[model samples]
Target: MENSASNNILDFLIHLDPFDQLPRDIVATLASTASVKYLAKGESISFHAFCEQRYLYIIRKGAIEQRTPLNKLRARLGEEDQFGFTFLAPLRDSEDGYRAEAIDDTLLYLIPHEHILDLCEQHPELHDYFAATAKTRLDSAVRSIVKKEDKGLFFRSVGEVASENIAVAKHTDSIMTVAATMCGKQKSSCAVIVTQGEVVGLVTDRDMTQQVVAKGIDIHLPVHHVMTTNPILINSEDKVIQAISLMLQYNIRCLPVVSDHKVVGLLTTTHLVHNHRTQSLFLIEKIKYANSISALAALREEKQVIFQALVESGVSAEIHGQVMSMIMDAFTRRIIQLTEELLGPPPCEYAWMVAGSHARNEVHMLSDQDSGLVLDDNASEDDRVYFAQFATRVCNGLAAIGYPLCSGKYMAATPKWNQKVSRWKDYYSKWVASPEYNKLLSISVFMEVRSVYGKSELVDNLQEHLHQTITASPRFLSALTRDAIETSPPLGIFNSLVLEKGGQNSNTLNIKKFALNLIIDLARIYCLSAGGSLTGTEERFQYAVKHGTLSQASCDNIIGAYRFITQVRFKHQLNALTQGNEANNNIRPDEFSSFERKHLKEAFKIISELQDVAKLKFVQGP
Candidate 1:
């Protein structure tokens, strides 16, 4: 029913991002309204304030170079790429230097600026897509992908929104007295039971009604007799969503907030549900109750949806990483439990430890499995066999459900990694003592480890031993410094990007390798040198600054750089996913707008400066 030219335009629009997300009717209307123009080689089109008509230009068949009035090349755009965003809004000055010149005989589709404005008015979200700067468009693209939901309140901290004036009672107090205390304070529905300033239990009105009155228990009994001992608690600084997740997971109506082991406040489901949506909380609950591997795997898609929502809501990278890591922890713990049931219980105590990003609580969608098994020293050969088989099932099951196996085989299934407590200490000692190239790789991966399941003391003891050894050996830290700075941030003279040469990712930057990893390594060096055990990169930097090992100014600069680079990387990955492409860290320079280009160059400069600082402080001789 359509001509070949119209069909061609429609096809092109359907494949590009933002446009790809538009309704079919909108695409059809765009195709109907678009006007075509041809430009000969070396022909230039200049936009100025006096032009009565304005247009959004899309290159249809050839290359176009955008330049400033000073004739500096700003960007190169090809087929399916667009420009002329200034025309979408009114201009104040004619000096705004933007001109497009065709590199060859070029075909272009030009849509009137008024049309774009009309569409933006009809769909308010599209305004970001048509924004004048690349950063704005990129941000808008992220926001556009998320379905509309409750936005406010999720980002607020639990302590800020939680009820601070909570009823408190001693464990020795009578149940009737505790209930009277709660009633006298009209705002309190729950009473926290404490003994010598430590929260020992929690008693709610429901608990009193159900456990006391319904069971015909004496009201004069001490609250501890009817209280839920060792009740789950949340730190005062935790996010509101975390409280919601905890409540849903444990089926508890309320959680006591604790700081310094003392109850500070109370957070109930009523507080969270009053103003926030609990999609992430409910999704985690679904993950917990998932009956089979297939059902668990299906929930992986839902995880992406929640991730998109969180990113769209504009939460910081730290929060994003924390939420993602919590989800991964939930998945890993549940999978281990399921595997244990299928393979039968272990013969000895063992700790399932996660390393790298999961341990640092910095997980993203592309995070792979980096886990190890720490067995009790009492384990025999038979115990090793059973644990090895169990580890295989857990690792294989994780791969089946979206998380791929580690390319370096750092997972628990590897016998070399699955070891007794003493053996793990020996491994750390050997790695730290030698500090060889290959051994440094092992140390870097295994250095920041956290126990996800089983006896946590096994992992804690190993961590303490590692810190002691590293602190005692300055040569090892020097070697680590050398290793950290070996791969410097890719920056060229005159503020250009130094891209990978002649590989599959040629002309693209490996963001993880050149930018993110450098910041991570610097953080690790500073923290380890200070004998600090913090894992999160930002926190590590802060700890070093707090300990006077690193300057606060340098820490702030590096952290800002780290956050920007991470935000850009995440947006790139999000864009790939939105377009149904496999998400990766390889980003083409042309994909970035001029604004993003400027900031990215600044971030790379900051990383380069920090690498030199590390080299001066640790790598060079005194």
Candidate 2:
């Protein structure tokens, strides 16, 4: 039989993160060695550099504020939050260490540093939980949730797995020569076609068999005749999962791995299969072959599993968004194909475009449909009627397969949104010339458009025109900046989260409206001002840095802030789904732990600072 005090400590430790992953026997051992101490409000605790014995302090009640020697607030810890991690290592005499002051009368559980060291030796994963930065801890938290088998695969880079034996050929080389090179010395399945010392095209074994041999084209002709010109390329530094995503998206088995415009290696589907098939890759394949609406709907259940897997695997936020967006793309493409099968081929060329989060490849479970149809200029009145009916079926089909219809009627089903290429150009021109508040909101979403199905050139032309128009109009950029900075991060005085005051979400914070949207706006403003068309938030920041619009340090801080906030929002939604609750953007402050609360405040502060920077840069003085 256990005493009540011991039982209480054990229960609390078992429920906390990182510890929650520990074995029961270890938890019992930890609880047995822990001692308790209480501090009165305004009392301070300090650790000397010369001290031989150190303890990891976990707050059991009240609050403890940890600060640097200069009195800068490093973190604020409340119940169940631990500190003293910095003292785990040996300290030198000249070291200016941290101080913890009790903000309220606090009770703390102290575990010897020696005990923690031994536990870490026994369990290596525990080391990440005690990492110095919030980002590292959040990453570790993500890893802790993943199944053990999947851990090694997610952390490995594409360069490590990609084959170094890259088969190379010149664009002027004969198709037979390329095939012979792939088969003979290179032992490769794909050959890169180089022209003037730059990679111009890709010729795969499939191309040799399908395009050259099957079509009975002259094998003596240049490989460029059969090769895919300007093929998709991946950087060597990108993660393996991203390579897997690109393969699944383009339905290709091979990709050229480039470093500084030079072909370095090749990443193929076989490489991914050797590692182990990720659920995301497999789900996309299943989605491609899914013939009926019911079959596609059944695949929806697997999406939650895939979402959980991706979250737990500790992949970056960009990868998360890309995977989810690819799934949406597959769904849309299949729906469009099925619609075409039912209602004859379209009379003219059209592009089905998805805007907003989906276009940015930042979609999550809560994403709604934001799509439009761009028809050719030559489309007749009868063509408009045909496309309208086609769009209705596609929208309803998407709603049936888990994606809800656009609440604002921004979908192709709306007659106003489904229009000709010339009409879209006029719309973009008008929006830029006169950007009122209501029109700016629509422009912000529409500007991030990507063609998911049909002719992509239509969307590409419109996007190019939009960028050209904005580049020429400084007033439009200023108006966009003013709109971007209109909604600041929900930071209350003293760096607290400003919660909703009333209605269904009373006492909760809308993470999307306050944090995510603000970051997105800043990214958009920076990219638009720079005349860069990248849509993803992180990529936009990187583009800004590359274009000298944003400093490297500022870009890094904003990226970190975006990743942390996005991870928090994702985990919240994952938790809600697991517990059979409706997943929404609203998060109650009470639901956050001390670790989350601290980092979230920091993230909010970063967003606010960046918003100010955007205002100063884009909004000229009157």
Candidate 3:
């Protein structure tokens, strides 16, 4: 029995991330002193109500449900999962320990807190393992909570709200009667025409009014003749917010909800619109009142509240980005105001320009500052000197307002970034007209450029001239493709995930760098080549679809990948912010489920395909 328990304990320790790297002999020594026990469903393991004895636990079999007042099962732990690191905190603060229960009949290996501490005290490596990875498990737990909240925006499943008594119509039914039945029921906005339980077409109020009534068609005409064929529809599992956005976007009043292409129910704008309006008002108010750093600090308090609010409102990510962009813009304007007061008056007329994320108006949660200036090209030499000094003060003040300085030396205060419009045009032209690697990399920065708080005509004219010159060069586009190609995705030989080896983020994949940048780069190229003028990745994809530069399937894959990565990155940043750690984009692969891992791989493959297409079309050699 002792040997059996020891084996289970050793197995569990081998899988625990920080301890997993230790030599086998050391792990074996630790496991020999561990006690493995069985836990029945709903049993309390770390009952602070009973005792203060600290114990480290490794779940060997079965699951544990975390109970909360919100009716939330915070997590269900499985085999080889670790828990009960609360011993690391002071006893007074650790009293609110997690309550564990067996989701199924289960087993756990427990190491006495005293023994664990003793072992760590003896071995520096073991101490490092526990110390470094303690926060990781906590972070993982918090991130799990954040994802639950993020996905909660659409948590209502089709099973919960979908109709059982769906209205149906035959292809041969009279259009007038179908319309009358829909109007009379007042509950049904659409009638699904089914042939052997397979969807053939969908008829709605708009079809009757536009196709039958206004056209003077026969009232007894077949419904199929008037109804829309192959209507755009959504799956029953989709969130109501998405359904509402689709309706608003396509100008359709209702969408058919399908299950395996069989009509399950009809979703209407009325249900979605009511919910959307309520949520959007709350979000707008929250952002407006987030006037100070202290006010914005509440965002880190509720992990995913901000992102969840944006997603559930069903606004396009582009619009959602703009909302964040506007908030940051207001925040920075205040920063400039404070700085101007500190430095007295500017010696000359100059326009402040927000660059990078703010310039693209793609500032979401956890973004830093990027800005510059456009002064009158005709300013005297002495006037230019004073203006530069004023610009430096503004940039420094932005840093004080919680906007961290750019690590890449791309801020407005720098002389290279701040310049006259005529010189800016010359700088842009040199890069666009040249075919060199460094210039192409610099130009890619311009891919997301937008004028914020500047003389509008100067920025507009600069863009027009730059766009005209860049598209004129086949060699420049090729060089851009080459620059984009350097960041090869971190995947194994068979396209399995490749994780970072060491550091605080060992075993995590850098999601934003390897995954999202591919989509962003591809979208940037598409926007440049097609004469489309949007900076955000989603807008570029939308424009590509409308202009026929990208097929529907290609657009779907690209947008899906972008959305998934954005969601993951936002959650990662939220977790970092909560722990008072600097925000970052790296995410551990071990934290994701098998299905999520699969989707990440598929997204990377789609990006690789897009790059291949771009290489063929634009990455031509000299």
* TM-score leader: 2
Provide TM-scores for the models: 0.67, 0.71, 0.53
In model 1, the worst 10-residue window by lDDT is 494-503
Error of 3 at 156 (Å): 10
Selected candidate, larger lDDT, 1 vs 3: 1
lDDT of each: 0.79, 0.82, 0.63
lDDT of 3 by residue, 1-622 (tens): 3488678677767767556667887788888888868877766554453356667777666765544333333344455555565455456645343466675788878887777787777765455334322233222322333345444434566434555445688888888778777766644767888777777888877777788879999988888888788778789888655564455335566677887877777766455546543244233334335555445445333324544465443344565576566656655655555556666766555667666667777777657767667666776787777767777776665565456787776777788877788888888889978757777666666555665554666677777888878767666667777788767554321112322122122455777667777778888777777778777787788788788777676777677666655655665566576687777776656666433443454455457667767777777765
Residue 444 of model 2 has an lDDT of 82
Backbone atom clashes (below 3 Å) for every candidate? 0, 0, 1
- Which residue pairs show collisions in model 3? 508-588
List residue ranges in candidate 1 displaced over 4 A.
1-151, 156-201, 205-217, 222-225, 228-267, 270-277, 493-496, 499-505, 620-622
lDDT of 1 at 384: 94
Candidates 2 and 3 compared: the better one by TM-score is: 2
Tens digits of per-residue lDDT for model 1, 1-622: 5667767788877766567778987887887778889999899898776677888888788777666777745555566567777566676632365788987789998888888888888888778768654345544433433334634566567888878868999999999999999988545889999899888999999998999999999999999999999999999888776676567547688889988787888988777655434554456667788877777898888667767666665566777788777788888888888988888888899999999999999999899999999999999999999998999988988888788999999999999999999999999999999999999999999989999899999999999999999988888888999888777665432123433222132577788988898899899999987889999999999999999889886887788777777777887888899999999998877787544554565566567667777888888563
